[model samples]
Target: LTIKTKMLVYKACVLRRANLPSVTALLKQKRLRWLGHLSRLEDGRIPKDMLHGELSEGIRTIGRPKLRYKDTLKAFGIDPDQWETLAGDQNRWRQYLHQGIKVHDRNWLQRLQEKRVCGKQAAPESPNHDTYACNHGHGSCKSRIGLFSHMRHCKP
Candidate 1:
């Protein structure tokens, strides 16, 4: 399907029906699994250190900080502070992860439905005519030929 296809439609009609996860869900699942593994690792391991490390002294840019992997855990309803404890038990972590994924997926689907409804209500109806409007603030035209002619010498 084209990029113009609505995500709610695509996920409901294709991904959910096919029992396939969206790329985002898959990535989050994998990241959480990897985090569980890292949490179980022995101390001082490079990957685990990187996951938990913070720079002691660095010049900060004057804006919001960049999002880290642990920050995303909140989206799955996992507290970043408690994730290590939760991931300590292999079987329990696996079960929790699955439940979290389900919760996240449900929330995501609900948000998409809300957005679709809101967008429909907010969007203005397009005029039914063979008119073309320039995206660069130029005037519109009644036909493709007129639009093309206007565009040839058009300036933003």
Candidate 2:
């Protein structure tokens, strides 16, 4: 994708994250130079909804059988039953998945919901201690709250 397209995609990603409405108009404003190309493509293009529906139907009817999650977990030397016993919460199970634990091959949101219900998973963990600790152990951090406090103090 061109830089302009990449930026548009990034904006769309941000909107999706925030559950906001389409910003295609904003994209058009920034990328008016590419309007010619967009007009040409739109002349005979397949509708996105139709394309998505076709792909979805194709996937739903794919041939050949697949192993279930239980089987997959067993093949990986993990016991779903035993894991369930120790899970104690759905959130923990989701965290286990997020932590790269081999499990019953379930979808993430389902696992997250399960973990949430069981109180097993806590809030997402920090990937490292770097966010909290400085290289020199000065006790100053660059986290969101820290930056807010810094701005408050530094503002005239």
Candidate 3:
């Protein structure tokens, strides 16, 4: 089993046991927890604010858009439109996670991990790149995860 760190660790994530709180639950809970924390702080400059549509002032590339934490949530059947406000009610957040856990599966785990990785960079450009290695923006990931299958399973 992995150390089970919360989201926003800026590092690769892992999930082992299938019969536990799904990785999706862990991540959603973490994000919602942080959302509540940030809302309590009442700071608009935080990065989380940008996620909540607080500010929109940048132009992004049109093609091959980078996957975001929001996209990862959508992959799990979550509509993050009200995610920021939803976090305020801890019980509601827990209820959402409880509902999410009921349906979380291996496909959700694999794709979420893939989105987390893709958030750091463009997809593998080098065909010769280590397909089985996790170039999870840490130069390398010690988890020894294979991105080839993720590559096949998840498309940008």
Candidate 4:
């Protein structure tokens, strides 16, 4: 089966179906999970410092800038600076992950709602309606918030 079909089967959206986690989000969760596993390891056994440490030895080429591991952590609402301490508490770390990862739709809804309230409308297919691009990229659609909502399920 195709990636889209698999994802649709795996995830369930609140208002609609097909809303799966983005690649970046899934990766962040995986890394956080690894951090949680690493926290349980004894010091010096698996290079604990290295796993929890930041390496800033080399210079990166200038441009749009690459996504760093630290960047993903920050994106997932984690503060890398004190991540060691935070991860020490397994329950706390798990709670944070659960809350952060589960709120993607809510976040998008908040963005779209705020836009509507401010009269900052998305380009609609009709004068009174909005068109969301297809998640499968087949074409555009006229489903009001589908434009904003399809973002989570859109395939690259």
Best by lDDT: 1
The C-alpha TM-scores of every prediction are 0.66, 0.20, 0.39, 0.47
- Colliding residue pairs in candidate 1: none
Position 45, candidate 2: lDDT:
63
Q: Candidate 1: RMSD over Cα atoms?
A: 8.0
Ranking by lDDT: 1, 4, 3, 2
- Supply the TM-score for candidate 2: 0.20
Q: How large is the C-alpha RMSD of every model relative to the true structure?
A: 8.0, 22.8, 16.8, 15.1
Tens digits of per-residue lDDT for model 2, 1-156: 233544544443454466443333233222322322232343346542342233334454578676444443453344646644434444544444333322222233355467667886466876554555534445555585774565555524
Clashes of each: 0, 9, 0, 1
Give per-residue CA lDDT, model 1, range 111-150, as digits (tens): 9889878977956865544458866767788777778888
lDDT of candidate 1 at residue 56, scale 0 to 100: 98
Off by over 4 Å in 3: 1-18, 21-29, 43-45, 48-63, 106-156
- Could you give candidate 4's per-residue lDDT for residues 1-156 as a string of tens digits? 234544544222424444555554566788788877787788887557786676679877888897665765666677878877878889998887776565644555566577667786555555433245565676675675666676666677
Q: How many backbone clashes does candidate 1 have?
A: 0
> Model 3 clash pairs?
none
Please rank every candidate by TM-score, starting with the best: 1, 4, 3, 2
| Global lDDT scores for all candidate models | 0.79, 0.42, 0.57, 0.66
Evaluate residue 4 in candidate 2 and report its C-alpha lDDT on the 0 to 100 scale: 52
Which window of 10 residues has the lowest lDDT sum in candidate 3? 9-18
Return the clash pairs for model 4, or none.
132-147
Where does model 2 exceed 4 Å of error? Answer: 1-65, 74-77, 101-156
